[model samples]
Target: MSNFNIFLKQGTCSYCNNSIVIQRKHSGENLCPECFQKNIEKNIYKTISKYEMLKSKDRIIVALSGGKDSISLLYNLNIIQNRTHNSKPIIALIIDEGIKEYREKSIKKAKEFCNKYNIEYKIISFKDKIGKTLDEIINMKRETPDYKYACNYCATIRRRLLNDGAKELGGNILAMGHNLTDFAETYLMNILYKRLDIIANQYFFKEENDEINQFYIKKISPLIRIPEEEIFLYANIKKLDYYPSHCPYREKDPIIRKRVLDFIQECKKYSPEIEFNLLNGFLELSKTLYYHRKKKNHSLCQKCGYPCGNGKICSYCSYLLEFS
Candidate 1:
């Protein structure tokens, strides 16, 4: 037999003594393919149950980008839904940012995956909704004095699209594929910029009021506990047909989010549990901040009737005005 086959056959799983297929460095666990897959699925299930993320009556709108993290999340959610009694329907929502060569391929994969699994899906486009593709937005704003990065524009528009699409579809919960690394990186970015309002708004444990529920669908990230690399591995091992490429703008733009992610990865070299620590800190800090600000009344945006922090128009509407 070849050396690769010999290596695969030699080692046993740390938990089951079955032949190992994956060796996790941070956890120091050698797992067989079956065990690794099962462990990931179990973690996702536990995350949902622990956070009360889903209810039987909730219509879940999955933000499917056709990437590994999203593909894994959707697949696991389907499994969980299947095992439950009277499970709510899951609808895959895709936002086409209109990036040439990038979004087209991913959307194709997303449609194929949804079709193969018999899941209902909807597609909305930046051109249709915002009157501009991401490429056009970048070109239009690149030379402006207060020019925002491509990621900023992309995230802002995509978030609004997802929320509006889900709400229109009568979805009660919107599930995203933000993994552990993303959570950690975002937490650090908020801290660095001293954006306490953003942090408070993102507090996961806040009691939902009518004003909040009316506009914002409850958002959940069941993959938040799992690292990005692990999700990539899981998607590949499970033979999921997912888009392997990332957004072209992500690497090219000098965004702070990329820098923050790089910093977290560097810290992981010296301290393996740094990401977990950041996540824990975020949980505590967000809870404290939420309680501190919970009593403050939220004003509705004049244009969209969504909850706004201070201004009469919500940020989404404000951005829309800029494009108009």
Candidate 2:
């Protein structure tokens, strides 16, 4: 037999002397199922501690979409909160964007998970808060001459709604489920677009004023160090009840973000550590940009009184106006 076949025949887990389940190419570790799951949890815990993402008194609102990443994050954070001394129970906040077949299925899975764990959860929809569902919004704007992609509208509205909803629920921190690949894609997109201001805004150690905190909850991503594929693996390995489909819009949209994501995924085949490198670059570059860039005083949106970044209207409001 060949050396490759021989190596596979003798492949035991690097962590435990058990049969290997998966080999992480980037780290060159052969891991059994149990050790792999444990390592993921430990890495999440370490990331939380390293970034000071949580405080004992802080109320956390997890952005749950019933997908693999969010479900995995909620599962881990639930365990952590239960063990912590005085942390408030994390709340799962689901955004119902009103996509007919898509959002309904995901929301069902989200509710089931929350019910199983007896976690407090809330559902807010674009229809109730923004006067129209995402589908309706798309139907209205799809034919407009200046129409943008569905993802752009969905992201802007979802972000504002999440922040407002979390604040309304008295949460001081909002935990997101974005993974390393997500961050890398976003970082590369912003770099390509030369959106340095956006990069600076992502600085983890940026000072928080009470005014900004009132409108925007402190956001953290405990899963930022994990990759998208690994989260998918962990979720499946743990038998998590997560939705196994991507948003239909994401699949069908002709957005540049999709191209950027494709580029990153393609690069990963050649460079296993490319995502981690981009993440590190984002961390350092964001910090440097945050400190060195000239501070632009935030101006409140005339309609909503939230910071508009020296503009008279925030992107959320501008989109709403366009929809009108």
Candidate 3:
């Protein structure tokens, strides 16, 4: 052997002595992989307990995008339930936007994970429900006057689809895998667009309203506190298999949403806790927003019978009528 000394790549937990390949920068722990997992799981448990997101018998339908954040959430929730044998079992709900190549791969991964966990998996396609796929919506919008951003149509339709799909599948609680970055971006977007009503409703928790309760599924975000970077890191650390590409339309959106996110990320170099601060601001403003939305609930949409403002038809009904 050569007379050279090599530094041991000591894979040891910063938090504990358990071996780990990764380390959490914020927590400053050389934690064993399991301990790192536990750290994130603790956040999920805290959120659930704080918000009371789930009830004993409430059927939960998770919005799994075949991404690491969602996979992590499903895995954690499963582990929690397995530990407690808690109220009702969880299911995964994936809405196919009908992006053949993108969705084909993602949906495959989603189904694979769901099957492995033995969790019930349900896929609702835009074509089946909306009579047109996302591609159709994009093309239609592109041709129309007063065109909306691509994300605008995609998000709106997807939101409606998620609510309806959850309801159709007997899902009282719809868990979304929106991480901290997503939440901050949404908050900033609302501020930019001056959509106070949406801002008010952006809180992680919400009290039920009769009109909304009638048509909408109760949505929750267990990954609300986890940073996007952390989720990406965790997924890589755990060797989680997920679709890696972004939606092609995302880059083409005319809106400033992505720019805002980029700014936030750049600011994070100077202050990593900026997202947390924004989250706090959102929570503080949400109470005022809740009262505002409740007061703003006006007439019902005549077309679909859902609540609508000054319009003859609700946004959902109008989009359907116009598109189909």
Highest-TM-score candidate: 2
lDDT of 1 by residue, 274-319 (tens): 8889988988898888889778888988998877879899877887
CA-only RMSD, every prediction: 3.2, 3.7, 5.2
Off by over 4 Å in 1: 1-11
Candidate 3, which segments miss by more than 4 Å at Cα? 1-14, 17-32
Q: Native-vs-model 2 lDDT?
A: 0.88
At residue 226, what lDDT does model 3 achieve?
Answer: 83
Candidate 3 or 1, higher TM-score: 1
TM-score of each: 0.94, 0.95, 0.89
Arranged by TM-score, best first: 2, 1, 3
Could you give candidate 3's per-residue lDDT for residues 91-110 as a string of tens digits? Answer: 88898988758888888989
Please give the TM-score that candidate 1 achieves against the real structure. 0.94
- Sorting all predicted structures by lDDT, with the top scorer first, yields 2, 1, 3
Candidate 2 lDDT over 148-228, as tens digits, reads: 878989999999999999998899999999999898999999999999888998888878777777788899999999988
Clashing pairs in 1: none
